[model samples]
Target chain A: MTAALIWIFLPFTAAIGLWAWSRHPAQSTRLATLLCLFLATTAWLIPIGKVLRLGPLTLEIQPILLLAGRRLNLTDTDRPLLIFFFTIAAFWFAGAQQAGSHRLFIPYGLAIVSFLVAAMAVEPLLYSALMIEIAVLLSVPLLFPPGERSVGPGLLRYLIFQTLAMPFILLAGWALDGVQANPTDTNLIALASLFLSLGFAFWLAIFPFYTWVPLLAGETHPYAVGFLYLLLSTTSLLLGVEFINAYGWLRNAPQLYLFLRWMGAIMVITAGIWSAFQHNVGRLFGYALIIETGFSLLAISLNSRLGVEIFTMLFLPRVIGFGLWALSSSILLQAGRSMEFQQLERVAEKWPFASTGLIVACLSLAGLPLLAHFPVRLVLLEQVARQSPLLAVWVLGGNIGFLMSTFRLLAVVTGGYFGPRQPGERPLQITLLSIGALSLVIIGLLPRLFLPMFTGLLSAFTRLP
Target chain B: MTLANLLLLPLLLVTISTLIILISQNWRYSVLALALQYVGVFWLINGLWPLGLAVVKLVAGWMACAVLSASQPAADVREEQTSPTAPAFRLLAAALALALVVSVEPSVEARIPVNRFILMGGLLLISVGWLHLGITTRPIRVIIGLLTVLSGFEILYAAVETSILIAGLQAAVTLGLALVGAYLIAAPTMEETP
Candidate 1:
């Protein structure tokens, strides 16, 4: 058995099967959650290319699966990636039904996860662009859903920017090949770098291109958008890290890291400032994610072992914060049928768990003390401060803007005349939100225990500092 | 036809079809133009890729056109109504795109070994396609614009890469884009949000 077959193709087939069963969303959710958890467990336990003894039967799972003259390779190092992807998949899927996500979400979400895994597993990683494009297309239905009256410009723009990124990345791959052939060719190197930057900028939705993030967030179900952003952001960030690790020139270029630092700071500042003015909780969710992405970029900008470690560590808090935010916002949106701050009066008094979840998520994203993002954000900002105190202040200014928005939300949710509460939030939702909020604080307080686990992620990028 | 004129045929087809797609409001006409544009793409790619592989682009493009065409009659009611000046505006935009393509062609050509006609055709389609996106908020038009952009990139990339895997994956992406476009058009008509 090949590791690629087990980790990539098997789940893809299961996703297709699950689509047939998506008519029963609850059952499909359960099945998908179990399948993803099982996959994650296998990734954690099994070693690719190593002998395994099952009683009298001995077996070795190969790393490569060949299809139509191409390869899907998953080595022992890749097991960490598999574990991460499937674990995140399980996390999202487990909460999907409770969040009132669309019925098709379970099946299509699994398909997206499978495609992203294929993107990671594919040889000549440039092909991941096409894989990501397929995933983006799959996400359209999730965003638009059925019976939606009128399509939003945000969704269309999301599709456009993502699709546009594909060609530039593919073309960049070809140029990099040229660079490989003629290492000292300055022109080829410059062209390749430009293409890669533009491609990733669109994919990651850096500053100017990020207009779609808030738009899509405002229009779609928060649960689906959360899943979409979480998977896309994580995959793109890993892919960017892989590029740096693979290319000596990219890693060695001080300009690339400098560009990353400035862009990271810029994204954080812009997203944070925008968040401060937003009255919509859903839009706030989008801005919060943008700030997280900005911090991730800053982490990479540090260009050291600590930087890479912080980058990976950021994911745990992000997943919990975003997950809680998406779930709580979804529950609240379903209750009120609107995400506008003015419309959701006394929401905290009405549904305390969901409201607290929202507040905790925003605070965590703002890097509040004793929240999930604090320790890593502290170290990253310290490193950035050491390099350039001015950039660190700008980043802090962005965080302050975001914190203002969070405070605004806190005020809105806490005040307003009390109305009769209707049996509060669902039990499952309360359980999930409570667990998620607790995890954030726990991770923040005991950073050493949870943060080191992400260090395993750095194993996949051995060449990085 | 002389060899020079024959080689230029694809570029002419591509330029005209891209302009037609940009200017035409009729979904049918735009779809037809898109198919013709793909024919031009296939022809340009034939010079670089094997005939068998080049056919994949035509087939995928035609399939995408078919998917999009099948989705339109119900969505016809929602199509944007353009002013009389809109077509002229689009033409002016196309003209600007052509100028940009002409100016950048030399620099682009310098960095890689590519046919001059092919390079011009690719750049023109991408430029016009982006113009199409800039002008339209409608899902179908944006998708067509994206397809055009991808087709343009494919023509240039065909010169640099020849892996069947890339070709197949690109074809799949084309079909996926079309399917998603069709879904967006038909989404409002479904019974409930799924």
Candidate 2:
């Protein structure tokens, strides 16, 4: 319990310290990075299984706090969830170190981690909206580092949409509370469901609400963009899961399930189509994430234990793969003069390892066979097909769109024929690329290795149903 | 009412004050508005004494306001030379404020504690201010607007009584973020017209 608390709080504490230290020009970036690593590792190493006990009482650390007349019990399932969160935090720290992100990265990364943990731990759902808003606000410094040119409109658009989503979520949580008090209140349940779906729709940046993703991609530093997308996408997916887990009524609602499925399918198809035409690599990544989110929604829409299992399994590989992709793209953009495809046409010749990493990562994202995404996609498709073939077709169409986009990206990277490599690239780039490529290959080759672990995690949640 | 409701009062006040700052046309009044707003918030939190840390935040905010006011150059002298629509704008703002207050009343149940009412009113005000600030082109107004929003959120933090430690931390963060905003305003972006 102490460890968990420290894990969550240390980042926030360090952020303030680093922000103060940042004013000093002589400050060592290495010291900040080492400190972040230590804190992140400590968080990752804490054992999550045992419930803390004191005398006759037991306590569980969770994202939600339920205050029922002095009886404070966290939800039972949040233990494993915390473990997952800490693990991701560790990976983010590693990525930050490898990328040599700006000086603000250390503090900003810590702040984001703290915010995400708080978002996960907050109770009653309404607080999640507020927490997410705080996360967005914190993200601005990361997105538009000091000395960068005019701030991207994407940040503003992101703020507006996210803020717009908050009221709906808060209102829904309040309405859900009313329904929970009176279990058979269909009217309250209906209102809660509508508000929640609408809120999530906005939060996920699905379909019509997705302009910010691409716009943000256009303006953001690749590494910052990567972190933002990962945090938002994964957290939103978890929130969707938590929403279902918390409200049994909504989970059982057939109409709600149908709505999620249809929306997911629509989002997948449209985002995929849009992605096929994107020339900018960052926007391409954004569209791909939008499609991936659609897949997650499809999994939830299935309303089955296996569906949830597939979703859980999908997270790790996607995070690793997407992080690699984002980091590589960031390096490419920094080294290359422009983000346009025409400029990137000879990227393979210029940066061979990075080009390979980008290609592999894109392939993994497209769920090509043998990549980490393959097995998850297969399971997701099977589940969808079993329920409805039309839905399956929609998902496949999205997959095809992802495939087309990847090919476009690949074509640009390879420049039609691989040429001689450029010299004087940093050794760090080589190391980052090799690790990313090796991990993708290993995970793709042995999907079963991680699949069972995720399946086990999913079972814990499914048992409640 | 519950202690939860009582704690929420400060949060509401801060929010309302922020909104007032955002929409207030005269830059000079915005700082005064924010100061008065923070005072109300501090008083409300001080009354509850939910967490020992609230005192620190209240003090920090007071100090920040003082420093900011001292450091800032007088409101653009050019504004006085260029415009005479201040009264009409103030009148329009007052009308909007009235509508906002009226609109929020239906949402607030009578059972809610009086302190919570004040807090809620403040939050609404701050949110309005933030919206006003975000839309406006004037750099000073934007900073004031953002600060008002932060203060409103800080007030909301008071109501979250269970996690006193987290609330205090959140308040500190709000102050830091506000300072950053102020810094941005003070050092105008290259894109902004001089």
Candidate 3:
């Protein structure tokens, strides 16, 4: 049996089965959590391409799976990626119970996992673009659950942007088909770079293409959008890394690095400026995510071992940051409070845990000291300063913008003045909120605690500088 | 019809129908024109695959139109809703798209193995479709624009690379787009706010 069958197909079949068995949101959440946890644990414990003796039987998982004239190669190199994705899935699935997403979230999320892994695994790698597009097609239903009478323009825009990206990336792949033999084909490289940049920009929601992020955040359920953003960005970033891994010219191009850094800075600076002036917390959700994307790009642009290390370090903190934001904001939303400044008056008095979680999450996203995102942001900034002092200032300016937004958000949640206090937070919610916030603070103070888990994944991109 | 004319017929149909869809005041005619455009796309795909496989493209397009038509308000009364822009805007857009397709086709053909008719038709659809997307606030209209663009992409990609996986994916995308479009049309409160 192929390892792809075990890791990819098995989960896919089970996801569908679970969906068929029950559409109850709570039941689906629990089942999905268990399934994702199981998948994640198995990925960590079971090494592929190794024979194991089980009582009288011998079991081994082969590395390749051939389906419909395509190959899915699950090599030892892919082990870390699988573990990373499944672990990420487990984290979100575990949150589903608290967030109360629809029943289809797990099933659709599982199927999305299969499709994304297939995109990575599929040979004749151009097919990955199609695979990714299929994932986009499925996301429509997931994002706009067939509820009654309405769908958001944000989801449509999201779909359109993602769809627009596919043709460009595929076209780039087609253009770069024989680039290895003709490395000096400057025209080909230019065309491919243009196509690739546009594709990644749409995928990453950089600069002008980022308007949909805030719209979707305000429109969709916060928890669903959070999961959607994390999965989409993580997968696209991996694919972006794969692009660099495949092409020596793209990797070595001094101009490309400069472009990435410039674009990253722009994303940061813009997100910062916009986030600061935002009156709605839902809108802040989008800006915080864009800030994370900008930071990730900046980390990649550093083009150093430490840069890659920082990139890896950025992951766990991001998961925590986005999770805290999604869960807290969702809790507040369920309590029938709008995220708008006027509506949010005295909300903190009613739901302290939810309010506190939202603030800490935003603060962490802003890279505040003693928050989860601070350590990685600090390392990345130090690297940037060594490269250029002026750019470092701009980068600092961006974070300060986010910090201002968080301050505004804190004030809004806390109120212009402390109003009438209620019977504080539910114990379960307070406990969860405390754990999430404490982790951020603790991880910031001692970065080593969570930094080790990421080191192994960094080695996967061995080709990166 | 001669083979040469058969080759030209669908392209002509596609161009005429898309132009009408772009400039027309009535939504019903626009939907019908989109279906006609898909038929043109299917003929273009015929050059790349077996007749059986090519039929999927036509089926998907027609099905999409059907779904859109179903969601549309009943057509007993006559009400024509023109675009906010002058008809001159479409003409200008078409001319620009024509310039783009004419300029880009030779290079596109050189890089990718596809039928010239398909390439030109698809390129035209893609170019005009992008214009349509950019100008519209209407969700259903935007979806039609997306279908137009994807029809172009599917024709080009199916020619360059032929496999069951991509074929299935293409069909699924078409079906999904139609579903989303239907959902949008039925949406009680339109979100053209963005």
Candidate 4:
């Protein structure tokens, strides 16, 4: 089997097999965790396109496979990215065992991950638009799984916006055809810029386009939405970088970079302000994600290697921070029927570990000191401060929205000093929560340990390197 | 009317029907209009692909409408009841949509080598589709709007590039949109929750 096909088929086939095996959520969960871990390990360890022998069986895994006349190419440089994708998948899949969701969470989750990987690998790469649309479609069932089904406003909005992005990207690719050779083609440049920005804006859920984020988080299961949100943003970021690398004019466009910065600041401030008033923890998590995107956009706006480094480094913290946050929310959801602030009054006493996980995850996402996200946030804000102190101050000020929620989440869980304390928390919850918390602190204190892994990421895109 | 306007019959049908679906509350009329819109799209796709491909476009669109129709409840108020101002709003949007298409179609026709009616049809569908999506909160209407928007892009793209790969991709996208609509239609209502 070719490298590309194997990566795509493993999850795609597993999704079908696991679903057919038994629509039981528990079995699907176990298989999904195992499959994700195996994929992650393979992605990390195996050399792409290397020939292998197992007695009489000889396998030469070609890096590219053609499907319907289009090439699906898997390169050596893609290994790190593939590893990142699978590892993040494994994290979510493993966490899914405790995070209450539909039976399809495991199966559909794998399929979505596979589709996203295929999107990154597909050549003529505009085809990635189709792949993303397919992934978005797969997300629909997850949003309104079997039995409990609300005609979620979030789901419809998500579908409409995501579908809208596909044509813009595809047409932009067509428009960019000869523009490189003809840089003087002002009209083409303008068209490409407009389409690409609109496409990315919808894909990344930037600003006003991001209403679906909080809405979905408020209504649907947190784990599923979190996974989809993180996957879409990461893939979109990769595509954005690819655009910069491909178009010399776009690569050099300082105006676009400034626009990204201004927009990033706005997203940060807006999401922050909204997060501050959110009474729903689920919506709070959604706003934190927007804050993360804003910071990421800010990093890109720097238009320098430092910016690229910070952005690349974000892959790690983003996965861990969001994973922890989603996992905790899902756990708490299982503990209680609802997470409305009043509903959560002192419920943390019964689910101590979940509450603790929720607090740490929120703080981690908020870029609090001594958490997974702090190191990157610190460096990024410092860089911003160096370029424009007001921007730095603005970003810091926006984070206060998350900070305010953190305090509120803590208060809601604690229920004042007079509240009664419950007995022991669940063993499994305790273990996962402890691991998440410890990892966040370790990564926070030792960002260097993980930062090096991402340093090699841009090298994969040699155009930028 | 000029030859372009003569050729614009199918497009005009598509634009008028798209507006009907957007403003009308009856699920039955909306489905009929949606199917007709797809038929209009199929006709416009001519000269770009084989007769077989155009048939595929028509069939896929019809199937999407069928899926959505099957999922709807009998005697459903899938969208809000029409207000007097709604039609006025739609009329204003129709005018704006017309302006949007007129302003861009010429530049598009000049820059890209495409049939004039095809260009205008695609732009008109896209403009009206966006307006439809923007104004509605109902899931079914939203789905129809999405289908319309995609139809415009697909029609334009088929003209620009007609590979089997592109055709297959677009077909899958249609199916995906249909499935989402079906899912949303069958989902338990929000009012069911306390």
Candidate 5:
């Protein structure tokens, strides 16, 4: 058996099966969640290229699955990525039932995750662009589920921007071939870099290209959109690092990291400034996501080992914050609230657990003290400060702007209500929110303990540093 | 006819088809223009790839059109109207895009070696398709625009890369985009979510 078969193909098969069974939403989601958990556990436990002995029968999982002149290779180093994608998939699928998402959510979610893994594992990583496009296409129905009356411009723009990236990356790959043959060709280098930059910019939704983020969030189910953005950004960021790591010229180019620093700072400040003025919690969450992405870029742009570590460390808090925020937002949405600050006034009185979840998620993302994002964000800013204090100040200004919005959200939700307080959230949702809120605090208080677990993620990019 | 003349026909075909798709308000004509554009794409690709491989683009493109035509709701047919001046403005934009392509074709060719006709056709479709995307908000039109843009890229890319896996995957993406377009069109008619 190959690692690709187990991790990539198996989940894909299960996704197909789940699609057929999706009419039974409850059973399908339960099975999907369990399946993803099992995959996650296997990814965590079983080492690829190692033998497993089952009472006189020994089996080895190979790294490569050869298919029609191409390969989907997942080595021992790929275990962490498998675990990361599947664990998040499990987390999201587990909440599908309570979120009142589309019935196809679990099935399509599994398929999308499988495609993303395929994007990573596929040989000649340029194919990853096409795989990502497929994932984007699969997400369309999830975002605009069949029967929904309005087709938001956000989804359409998302589709167009992502689709446009494929040709650029593919063309970039072709140019890189020329550079590989003649590494000193400056024109080739310039061409390859331009196409690659444009490709990733579209994928990452960098500024001037990020208008769709808020629009999609405002229109779609918060839970599903959250999952899509989280998965896309994580994969895109890693893909980008992989590209830099694979090419010596790219890694050595001083201008690349310089560009990243400016772009990262711009995304941070712009998203933060926009978030401060936003009325819709959904849109605010979108801006928060953009800020998180911006910080991730800043971490990588630091171009030091410490910066890379901070980048890797940021993932845990990001997932926690977005997950909690999405769950809270979904709960409020299913309750028929519009997610506007005006509509959310006194919401804490009705659904205290969800309200608190939303508040904590936002504050944590804003890098509040003793919150999940604070330590890494603090280090990231300090490194930026050492590089250029003015850049650090700009990053800080952005964070402060987002923090102001979070405080405003807190005020909106916590305002006066005369009625006797009664919990509107279901017990299961309450339990989930409580767990998520506590996780944010726990991870925040002891980041060193929890964050180190994800260090293995960098081991795959051996050449990056 | 000389090989150059043979190639020029398909080039002209794609240019005219894309222009028609851009200017036509009728979905039927737009769809027809798209199918013809794929035929032009196939003709251009056949120069580089085996006839068998080139046929995939044609078949997939036609199937994409079929899916889109079948799935478009009646409401969309009624609502696909545009201002009387929009097409005229689009036609002017197409002419400008063509002028830009003609002026820049040599430099682009220098950057990545390909035939002049293929380059011109690819650039024209890409430019017009991009303009189509910018001007339209409807899902069907957006998909058509994206398909046009991709079709342009594929024509140029076929001259450079010839991996069968990429070919198959690209075809799959074309069909997948079509299916998504259909889904977006039909989404409103389904029963409301619980």
Candidate 6:
């Protein structure tokens, strides 16, 4: 536990120390890159159940830590979550070095990681609002590059929507507290359950509240967008799990779960349609996130341990896939000096490796068969069918929309034969694409290997009773 | 007053101030109204010290407000110096304020859910300020609106009783945001003849 605490805090401390030393940009970048690598490595090395002992006390570093007044727990279920965050942190750092944005990226990346860890460590019922706020604030620097155009309006909008969602979550938490005080308080529990689900819907950026994601994506660098999306989706899903785990009464609220299912289905379909029409590469990434989040919501609305397991497994591939996509896009934007689809279209053949990676990532994201997303999609579909056949149709439509959008980009990237191709090839680009494509195929073929780990993680929540 | 009342009263005051700013036709009152709101927030933080970790926050809020006020431009130099107050602004503010106050004071017989009420009010005020800033073309007005929203959020965050680490991060992020806002306003892209 102490080691985990130290591991999370070290980068955060380094971020501050590096910021104060920002006059020496090179030194700051070097120090931050080291910290990022250190954090990523430590996250992978830590055993799932290893508890750290300090003198007279022993603290377990699992998902749940029951302190005197607050609970700081990380269950087996959270293993994938921690891995997702740290892995992204690591990749963002590496990509920043390659893209020459390390000075800004490192500090924001560390702060983001610290905020995510803090979000995960705190009990969701009590601290969801604070978690969202921290995530929002951490994103500001990343969204608006230093000395770039002001992201004031965009940042403010993000803050407002997130803050607006907080009251519902806090109120729901308060209601849950009331129910805990008296288990017979069905009325309070029901209201709390409804509010909590709705609050999560907003927080997760479903439909109407999702405007901010695209705006931020359009304005910010791809790496920043990836980081923000990862944090929001993963943490929001975990918060949903925590809510269900903490409130047993919520399990019986079939109507609320049904609402969530339909909501998720609508989000999936709408996001898919939205992605189909987007011209900007950044907006495409934003819509893709919305679609992915829709799948996660579908998994959660299944309201079973199986649903939880699938949701947890979803994060691993996404972290790798999105990281690659963001890196590729960042490279393309830098090389082309614009994020416009027209500029990107011209260089598609020139940057063949990056273009390939982007295409593969889009396919994986769309849940095409024989890719990383297939297994999870199959499970989610089965669960949705079990709930309602109409839901299955909705999920299918969403899947098709996602595929169509990916194909749209793939078409452009393969070349419309309209512009001259640039010269020069980088080995690292090829390596990244190959690794991404290889992992997608490997995971698609052997889904069971990943299933057990996520299942074990989900089982911890059921043990709460 | 009971410990609960101590918490509830200041929150009520903040909510009322939010309503005043929201409903007032005179945009000039917003800064004063927001500052007054923070003063109420200061009182709540002082009263709720026994909740643990709030003492540090109370002191921090005081220092922040002191520095901000000292550096802030005088009202005479504000962008709205010659603008006429609009009835539409007053109506919108009034409606929002009324809704917020009504919601905070639930019909049920209980001390208003202090923590939750304050949080809700803070969110509402900030969102309003955000909208005002986003829609306005004037740079100075936009900056003031953004600052108002941020300060409103800062007040609500003070009540969270976060760890020292989280608090420090929050402060740093806030400062960074301010610097970014200032830079944007100063940039040539933002300049226009008013």
Candidate 5 per-residue lDDT, tens place, B50-122, comes to 8889899999999999999998655555445668898889999989999999998999899757678888888
Scored against the true structure, residue B117 in model 1 reaches a CA lDDT of 93
lDDT of 3: 0.81
- Ordering by lDDT: 5, 1, 4, 3, 2, 6
Candidate 2 off by > 4 Å:
A14-79, A97-100, A122-130, A163-171, A456-465, B1-177, B183-194
How much does candidate 5 score in TM-score?
A: 0.98
Candidate 6: lDDT of B163? 51
Off by over 4 Å in 3: A416-425, B1-5, B48-52, B73-80, B83-85, B110-116, B186-194
Which docking category, incorrect, acceptable, medium or high, applies to candidate 4?
Answer: medium
Docking class of 2: incorrect
Per-residue error (Å), model 6, residue A156: 2.6
TM-score ranking of the models: 5, 1, 4, 3, 6, 2
Of candidate 2 chain A, the 10-residue stretch with the lowest lDDT total is A65-74
User: Per-residue error at A176 for model 6, in Å?
Assistant: 1.5
Q: Which lDDT tens digits does candidate 3 get at residues A1-465?
A: 897887788878877887786457677767777777787777777777898788999878799988888898887778888888888787777776566566677888888888888888887777787778777776765677655356667877888898888888877786677577688877777878888999888888887899999988988888888988998898888788878877888898899889989999999999888888888887889988898999999998998888888887899899988988988887787677777877877577888778888888888888888888888888899999999889999989988998987887788778766556773556766777788888888898989878767867765567887
lDDT of 4 at A215: 88
Worst 10 residues of 1 chain A by lDDT: A415-424
lDDT of 3 by residue, B108-194 (tens): 888776667878988888988888888776777778888988888877777666677777767887878887787766645433211
List the DockQ of the predictions in order.
0.85, 0.09, 0.35, 0.49, 0.84, 0.16
What residue pairs are clashing in model 5?
A147-B187
Backbone clashes in candidate 3 total: 0
lDDT of 6 at A264: 78
Angstrom error of the Cα, residue A169, model 3: value is 1.4
**Selected candidate, larger DockQ, 1 vs 2:** 1
Q: Given candidate 3, what's the lDDT at residue A207? A: 79
lDDT (tens digit, per residue) of candidate 4 on A306-405 = 8989999877877877877787778778766476888777766777777788888888888898888888889999998988899889889899877998
